[model samples]
Target: MNAEHGTPASAEPGTLRPGGRTARVRAAVLDAAGDALAEQGFAHLDLADVARRAEVGRTTVYRRWGTVTGLVADLLTDMAESSLPRSETGSLLGDLTANARLVQRTLADPRQGALFRAVIAAATCEPRTAEALHRFYDVRVREWAPCVRQAVDRGEAPAGTDAHEVIRAVSAPLYYRLLTTAEPLDPAAADRAAAATAAATRAGAYVRPSPAP
Candidate 1:
């Protein structure tokens, strides 16, 4: 279920650019899809059910998305496009903390948290969903990776720091906390996560390894 992929393939149908009726239909469908995923999880996410909630025809939904996997993949794409842009605070710690707080807030939201958990649970069983999940993270990681580069340019981090790894580190603990324990996600936890990762990066712990001999 850990299948990997890049951008979703061009083979998917029902994809639409922004604006017009097509865009509106896509938006409505995805919103309903998210609602179903949050309420009943992936296993229960039927395309027909989604169409009914979206007030779209079953044939339209089927023709556009083709399958549940295709619909989910498009949903991930929409999510990436709609997500907030990365913060630029002119400091590594500040940027990292901002990213951490964003992640914490997302996990703390009831509907959003349930949607993510449902996707993750489904990804474990569906290879296509797993690939889509990986792509979603890739988009998110790329979105925030520049902060580490800016830190390197500003001499705030080591020259060879792995920017993506640093960013992931800042969020990993928060996600772990969310998934493992029943603890409430608070601002303090986000700050601690950012501080710990920033300290590690400063110490060269996240430097990319040299290629093996």
Candidate 2:
């Protein structure tokens, strides 16, 4: 299990999100990879091409990430590391609204939206890619899950509320809209998603069930 945190960094890239020459190389490679994915999808991604685009040596790219799955996995790791921290808005609704807005903004951005679609498509056929994608979401969910727990503590949500489920629900609709219809992911749509999820959570629809004997 190439866990998000413990995976040994190859000698070239010094640390996660650190600043220096190695970090610049990493940033360049990831930016190039993203551009390729957004423009041509995962099927066309190549390490040599990414190296060329990043203006780094092909040997470095090959040495750092041995395969496409490894590179894509690293890209997802970087994304999770760089994502904004969860907002603490004092209420479940406010917090969920903030979460939805962030999702909406990401999906509405042409590059990021296309990049997500490309990775999702790749994940369907690639086992390693799917694992990486799941890990990426897990990181994001954990980030926002604390807010739901805070809601329970504040009495804005019922006891035994499943924090992760509530967080997922808030973002699900926005991602669905982005992937399904050719609809514009506007602020109104984000607000609706937040409202719906917050309402369901308050109604105890997301309460955790006891284990069966």
Candidate 3:
């Protein structure tokens, strides 16, 4: 997948999100794929198994996805498309707090947390999955970046602040905790992440450095 455009090099009909009947098939297959990944991890994710779980024809799965990685890539794309939109709470802290809480809730969910772990593990060796993961986060970052721009406009964040970086900072700690420790992803942790990011953003920590003349 192209990082900038989040599209495959070949824009085939199979790659595109379909409408009507095919949309139902796509949703089923992706849900099955996610369940398999969460339960069995990437190494055991079989297309035939996913087809059976989805109650679809094996040939349909093969013809549409071709391989497990292809199916996984599409799953990540669908996840990004289905994620909740960023909150607009006027204050930068409020907006970032909303973002953090969303991340916390997602990581705290058993199925979603397991699915993310499976995908992150797969991305370690699979170049295609890695690219898909990059595109997934890229889409998310872009979605919330406008809040930082709004902060700058409102004089809450410094001028020349890197909006994308600020958005990333808000979620980075939550993800790290999810991956590293066994601590519960509580609301307090989310609030801490939001506060830290908002403070750093206002202090110009994320300001883009000017090029040396």
Candidate 4:
């Protein structure tokens, strides 16, 4: 898309504008970066190369992102913000199933899967990249934490279950499949994850709430 298409007009310094010409430019650059990272890997992700692919000037890319790590960090933040909110299905199994399905769907998508693989590979060699990846997971995990908490309130899971950890457990295997095995991230995988997580919660894997003291 052209810079004028979705670029934001008033982004703070060193950040992509929220919406307008700058936003469009940022999206294009991010798309180009995803392509380059997937095709060539992080070692080959040159700002100039991304600029050329995005049809933007080198100065604009540099002025906004400053460094490769910075760009990746911003991309992660944007993705987290843009991702769908957690589902409130009112049951531990249902919520976890929803969460698992979302994870499977995202990792199975062509562009998103490739983008994650690129970032994962980059993380192995760069501390900053690894940190950014962790931050991305943190955002996603936090987003779904309440579902676990709600399950506890409903007595579906033991009170005091660490909501964050429960949520993480649901996606851990899915990510493992994405990063390691060539197995398809199908609904079966999602069902397995949901089942495992629900079973664990029922078993009191989550901490129980403290009794009145």
Candidate 5:
């Protein structure tokens, strides 16, 4: 695996002017790559074109990202890290509602929505891209897992509920609406997902099963 693919610095354009020319060049290349990916999709992402767009050399782009998958992996990591922290609203319903709203708002944004759709389409045919996409979700799920655990402590949910899975479930419908249904990712859909998932969790839908003898 390429180090740049996993390194946070490669995900976005760096602002540190002290790292000198090399850092600036790397940042420029990465930013250009991101724009290319967002605009053209992975199939049309050309390193030479990215270099031209960034006014950087092709050798620099290749030397840093190595391949399209590597670039995409770094981009996903960047996106995950840059995302807002999970809301702590002191209750499971409130927290889940916050989560759903955040997801709905993000998926409904024009630029981000298009970028996600393109990335998702790319992941369908690229195993590495799929792994990166999974990693993005894992980070998000972990971010909100504590909320579920807190709900359990507060007696809002069963003690054995899988917090991560519960958090994941809250967003599944929103993503389904975005990818499958042509329905708008609006506040109504967000509220429905949050309410449904919260109700299911309270009903023990996410509780772990008892071990079989």
Candidate 6:
């Protein structure tokens, strides 16, 4: 799902990546699956339904994905691989602001927002989906954690700061609003998230304590 290359990241077990016809089939099936999940949530996701939407054979979907959970897991992997790379703005606030805005815009999009909501709700009860969701956020966190490291190197944040935590902080409030309230995922909210994270990070809020000898 790389935005520029459309190339998927490494396959995990049931996730397939065969070339030519197989790849096209995979893409079509996943796209159809995402559409179905977004439109009707996971409870309504069926292999036959996905097959009809994808125009691929039902056997192919069954053989490749096996179950709804497997398909959803693969979809989450594709989303992680396709997400945009982090911005390098040479400062902690600028970098986090960029990150926050990206999350805001994505959650604010109608289809993407609904898709995310469906996936998140599914994760709450489905163990496989929850693991997939965790991995998805892990990929995204790793992608942006370096910006916090850079901030530390530039003296913008203290040494021993947990870069992953700082990156998570910038997106937490945005996600909270997306799930909890009717408020719009506006740019102003994104900016506030970034600013607050930057301030807290500078105050050593995310710093890890030294390990005991």
Between prediction 2 and prediction 5, which has the larger lDDT?
Answer: 2
Put down candidate 2 lDDT per residue, 33-133, tens digits, no spaces: 99999999999999999999999999877766778888898899899889999999898899999999999999999999999999999999999889889
Which 10-residue window in model 2 sums to the lowest lDDT? 1-10
In the range 30-119, model 4's lDDT, one tens digit per residue, is 878878877877877888998999999998887777788878777777777789999998799999999999999999998888888888
- The 10-residue segment of model 6 with minimum total lDDT is 2-11
Q: Per-residue alpha-carbon lDDT of model 1 for 1-213, expressed as tens digits?
A: 111112244545534554667678889999999999999999889999999999999987887788998899888878878999999999999999999999999889998888988988889999988988888889899999999999999988998899889988999998898889999999999999999999999899988888899
Judged by TM-score, which candidate is best?
A: 3
For model 6, state the Cα shift of residue 113 in Å: 0.6
Candidate 2 Cα outliers beyond 4 Å, as residue runs:
1-19
Q: List the residue pairs that clash in candidate 3.
A: none
Please write out the lDDT profile of model 3 over residues 1-213, one tens digit for every residue.
633234474664236876777789889999999999999999999999999999999987887788898999999999998999999999999999999999999989999999999999999999989988999999999999999999999999889999999999998999999999999999999999999999998889999999999
Candidate 6 deviant stretches above 4 angstroms? 1-13
Q: State each model's CA lDDT, in order.
A: 0.87, 0.89, 0.91, 0.84, 0.84, 0.91
Candidates ranked, most accurate by TM-score first: 3, 6, 1, 2, 4, 5
Query: What TM value does model 2 have?
Result: 0.91
Q: Highest lDDT: give the candidate number.
A: 3
**What lDDT would candidate 1 get against the real structure?**
0.87
What tens-digit string does per-residue lDDT give for candidate 6 at 93-208?
99999999999999999888889999999999999999999999999999999999999999999999999999999999999999999999999999999999999999999999
Global lDDT for candidate 5? 0.84
Model 4 — TM-score against the truth?
A: 0.87
For every candidate structure, what is the RMSD over all alpha carbons to the true structure, in angstroms? 5.5, 4.1, 4.6, 4.3, 4.6, 5.0
For candidate 6, the per-residue lDDT at 82 reads 91
| Candidate scoring better on TM-score of 3 and 5 | 3
lDDT of 4: 0.84
